[model samples]
Target: MLLFVRTAEAGKYKQSPPDGIEPSTLRLTAARSNQLSYGGTSTFLSIIVQIAQYNLISPLQIPESRILVIGLDDAGKTTLTQRILQHMGQPSKTTIMSTVGLETYEFKDKIAKDKSTYKLFDLGGSGRFRSLWEVYASDATHIIIVIDSTDKGRIFVIRDEIQTMITKIKRANQKILVLANKSDLPNAVTHDKIVNACKFDGVLREFQIRGLNCSALQDTDIEAVVDFVKSK
Candidate 1:
């Protein structure tokens, strides 16, 4: 899950760091260039260009991993996906249309000597689209299943769907990250209450799915979900 990608100057270019140059050195060079470029001026521009020519050889880089986001409709999977993208500085055009089948976004991150890239699969979350999930389910390295924390009426259906889907996949190595989403809602179900109602504890024991409570709109809360997926 911890994919190590080397940072290259150009987009899509990848390579390992040179033997002598540490990643910190490369980051420092980039930071200096950014600082110099902050206040645009002819003199400052020329000086920064000269400094960049001498010290900065490439762009800042880091390593990243992939995760698949899935759940029932209106459970905020798409919103969460966009939030994660924004967190990685790759915000895209916002829209409210339903995902036809599957959508993907790549997040590139800089970490130490390596640049990591995470491919996030934001799959459609409606029951009618469940059939399409199997095609990509096997390909996902990690799975995040988001449940509407306030939807007490649909708990049984949600639980059944999760169990059935995992049963169909039957991949022992596939890591599952469950999100009790919509926690910020006034009537949102408590994490323990949801787990009990859905019998997730029993299902987790049987299927071994990892579950957590989070509000995707909150960056701090969502970070835990990101960390869990990346841990794979």
Candidate 2:
């Protein structure tokens, strides 16, 4: 999620510093961005949530989410997940490597008023592993696709992957978030180009999908994403 932080006055809080205290809007916005647009070379992330009614079970009823993160190898999926982990206060690996078949990460974010638990599936995106996408997505509440913004040659492959995944997704309201990473690169593609190249208009007609430019490390607000999940 590409977030824009509009902080409040620091003079009000004396004890907490900027790093520990965030006063800005935790904007985790994406496709169907009625109020969002390409903020130039700022930060970029796209969210596609197939809105639907949700069924709750546990009494605590914290925001229970099963997020499926899938994309081509080296698309920065692992890195992006790690960044989100930092926001969630989860223990992250110091040395990140390519995921094997699939890696599962579970964390309960206590920062968002002591609610919300996230279970993320980081699946391998190589050719052989792509087949398992539907298998994992079937039970996932949200699906995230990460793409290397500079790789124009492989954009077609991304289109096919998304289209195929969309058809196989079991839940009609499963949401999707596209992280067009490496946007800060000298020759990276903009949010609009990624959407047009992926033919999102044809594939995501059920949604008012929109895009935004943002940095994965500096601009994401995992809390806003959790808020959306809780809304479902």
Candidate 3:
């Protein structure tokens, strides 16, 4: 026998973060249809349950965690994003020009039998767009700061940006992942060196920054990024 099921809904949903965290408002509007064939009564009932799962699941759905990646031009921000996506089996087209403004990459993953979506915002690192970085960073659950390990001259510039972002958020709970990129370069600075150069030695009250060596071009240490996200 042939069976066709169609479902549609439009409404507002509010997702509350863990205790002591702020809540977020989300509007969900979706419509879907599924066509299936049933060989027996048992099979038909199972299909019905599967089709009806959407409505039941939507209300209990977990909100996606937002991740922001920011850095100076030529810091390999975009390259790191592209490589991570590619490693996730979602490769995208590469561009040479620096990001003009804001770009987003979103995907879903299942961990420990729970499924959740993630949104990654890649903001342009040029002087013109740097001003807007804080706006996006404020809402992100985690932030990734990419740095050009070989460009020792930009250490101060990079340090200022990171500090400025922290000051803007004014939150001690912010989770920051610093990627000292271009680790494959012979002259690339070590992660420890990058951390020290950035003056991260100072006490950062509530905000936290963790630095890691990565080479986007060589696809090195990409798992560290994945592990960090999963930990969240």
Error of 1 at 197 (Å): 2.0
After superposition, the stretches of candidate 3 with alpha carbons farther than 4 Å from their true spots are 1-63, 94-97, 110-114, 170-172, 203-205
Per-residue CA lDDT of model 2 for 40-100, tens digit only, reads 2333322211111122234354236877778898887777777667666778877777765
Cα displacement (Å) at residue 11, model 3: 23
Q: Write the per-residue lDDT of candidate 1 for residues 137-169, one digit (tens) a residue.
A: 554567787888888788777788777776666
lDDT of 1 at 115: 52
lDDT of each: 0.59, 0.60, 0.64
Question: Candidates ranked by lDDT, best first?
Answer: 3, 2, 1
Report the lDDT tens digits of candidate 3 across residue range 1-232. 3333332333322222225432222211122232223432223332122121112224245346677788998898888888767665665666644554555666765333336677777777878667766766666677888889899899789889778866766453667787889999999998788877677757344666787999987889988986665556
lDDT measured at residue 178 in model 1 versus the true structure, 0 to 100: 70
Q: What shift in Å separates residue 52 of candidate 2 from its native position after superposition?
A: 27
